[model samples]
Target: MKLFQKLTPKALIFWTIGDQAGKVYLGILGNLILIFAIFEPAKINYARVLINS
Candidate 1:
């Protein structure tokens, strides 16, 4: 139970950071596709994002 308590916050923080990073990643990806019409670059990123999510 002590080990679980120690890890819980660390796990929560790690997940929060990961969530924020994914949001920023998708925002950039959206800008590229919408503003620049750059599908090639986003396609690569999209694949990785899909794998992650």
Candidate 2:
């Protein structure tokens, strides 16, 4: 979670820079990739744990 907290700011900064550079589509794609790679798995694992519990 702490790692995510740190990464969130960095990601936001990068996304902002990308957007300012007129790479909006690429920024959105990158955000989606990050969401799936990081958040989606955590969400699935949390749901599984809740169901098991």
Candidate 3:
């Protein structure tokens, strides 16, 4: 619990995405990741992902 408290602010700033709309958007992103992982094991293991800020 304390650990979560310490991390909460950082998570809100970097991970929350946004509001209710953002929640749905993140849900879709998570679902797509799950589906891709299940169906594309080789790609998941080998693909290089680069996130641009």
Candidate No. with top TM-score: 1
lDDT by residue (1-53, candidate 3, tens digit) is: 77667776767666555666788989999999999878797665556443321
Model 2 TM-score (2 dp)? 0.50
Clashes of 1: 0
Name the lDDT value of residue 47 in candidate 2.
100
Q: Which candidate is the best by lDDT?
A: 2
Q: In model 3, which runs have C-alpha deviations exceeding 4 angstroms?
A: 1-18, 42-53
Q: Where in model 1 is the C-alpha error above 4 Å?
A: 1-7, 38-53
Tell me how many clashing residue pairs each candidate has. 0, 0, 0
For candidate 2, lDDT tens digit of each residue in 1-53? 77666767779788778778777777888999988999888999999999999
How well does each candidate superpose onto the true structure, as a TM-score? Answer: 0.54, 0.50, 0.43
The alpha-carbon lDDT assigned to residue 9 of candidate 1 equals 80
Local error of candidate 1 at residue 24 (angstroms): 0.2
Tens digits of per-residue lDDT for model 1, 3-52: 66677787978988999999999999988778666667788799999999
Model 2 weakest lDDT span, ten residues long: 1-10
Models, CA RMSD each:
13.7, 15.5, 13.3
